[model samples]
Target: MKFAAFSGVFIAHSIQEAMKLTQKLGMDGIEIAAREPHLSPTTSAPRIKGIKALAADLGLEIPVLAGYMGGFSTASDQECEQAFDDFNRLLDMGGELGSSMIRVAPGGPNAFLAHDYHYAKAAHWLNKCAEAAQEYQIKLVLEIHNQSLVETVDSSLKLLHLIEHDHVGMIHDAGNMYITETDYGRDSIVNLGKHLFHVHVKDEIRVAEVGAPGTFLNLTHRGEEGFLQSRLGEGAADHQPMFDALKEVGYNGWITLECHAPYPAYERLAHDFQIVKKMLSWEHA
Candidate 1:
């Protein structure tokens, strides 16, 4: 599997700076966060072209664009349309950026309020987006996140089944899955099978200790839990089993380092890269 650093972790840095830092950290690519202070819907073609050229020059791949577009579960049709419109723009940008995939949220009213109808609505809109994404030769991947309808593996598979498009798939966000206390590791990855389009690796721990520096609380459908983001392998979420499962599944897609631990972005990314390199048995030049 190839490795990448999520640019969302480098929000404080310029796009160029993020890209450079990613390359310097010995990553194979950079997953550009397609939002503010980075590349947004309003970002021009010239800027997109320049970003692509720079990535190429730096020997980096632009594997995926992490977009902030999603309202597929909202109560209004107009809101869904607007979200789709923004997603369409992101697809156009992805085409110019030469990215193969883009990350999408399933929908949110949180997991508790989201019902089967919300899931169906999200699938309908996602299928529509899949059609649009085909034009740009990009794959739309739904992130398995807690605040959304696709929080668990079963729910995510249900949405994928409803969408029924080969161009759409799932991002196995291990950290979020851990936070939600959902099924993960070999079982989840094997279940995802071909639908596991991409992966995000971060580490998290329960706030049993109470006084951790970066401790925060997350209230989800599964109830409330105090959590802290930690460096990979140093946290409660062990990724070795997940990596083994990816190998078993022959998943050669991008694995993005999306650590949100409170630390300097460069240092965090660099430290995480070493761990990932070891995990994947990847060697540098």
Candidate 2:
């Protein structure tokens, strides 16, 4: 498998600067984030063309588009239509940039009524999106995030089975699934092996109590406390086993480093990239 970097963690800088950093870090490619303060659908074609040209000039390829942030659950018909419009635009841009996969999180905080309802909604919308994506021959991979409906492996499998679309798959995020109280971490990957299209590598640690033995206080609200982000090999995530598992499954997809730690952007990303390179044994191509 190849190694890349997700630009989402580099939210502090412009996309152009992120591209430059990706090249400098000796990565094969990048996963662009198509959201505000990063990259948006409204970003002009010429600007995107400039990015493509730069990548080519630097011998880099964009294998994935990381941030298509519209969720289906809370969306009205109009909102869904707008999301569709935005998705199509992203697909067009990905085609222009020569990216084969696009990453999306199924639904955000407002999307889930309950687990089952969220799955049903996500399955329906993903199938529709998959049909739309087929026009450009792009694959839509859902990243497993906390607030997303497909947060666990079983849920992800259910959505995959329900959608039953070849273009739809999972993007396993090691850190996103790592909660202090639960073994949600490894299950997400183990359950969705063959269906995994991409991987986002990071680490997390929890220190607060949240009533349950394995449950951590929800850090988002002030009521919760004690959550920390660490570099690869520094936190709870045992990435080597994950790497070995991917190798066993013959997953030749991009393993992108997502440095969400609270360090300076450039330093953290560069360090994470090097650490991942060593773990993956990536060589110049």
Give each model's whole-structure lDDT.
Answer: 0.85, 0.73
Tens-place lDDT digits, model 2, residues 1-285: 777878887777887788888888878987888876656789898888888998898888899987565587666778777877888888889889999998766774412334566667667777787898888899998876665666566656766888868889888877776642323434545667678888888887775544443234343323345556777666777776677677666777788888777677677777777776676665831
User: What lDDT is reached at residue 135 by model 2?
Assistant: 80
Model 1 clash count equals 0
lDDT of 1 by residue, 40-119 (tens): 87888899989999999999999999988876777478877888888898888888778999887767766656678888
Report the number of the highest-lDDT candidate: 1
Among residues 3 or more apart in sequence or in different chains, the pairs in candidate 1 whose N, CA or C atoms overlap within 3 Å are none
Report the number of clashing residue pairs per model. 0, 1
Angstrom error of the Cα, residue 116, model 2: value is: 2.8
Cα shift from native, residue 236, model 1 (Å)? 0.9
Predictions: Cα RMSD each:
2.0, 4.4
Considering only N, C-alpha and C atoms within 3 Å, which residue pairs clash in candidate 2?
181-214
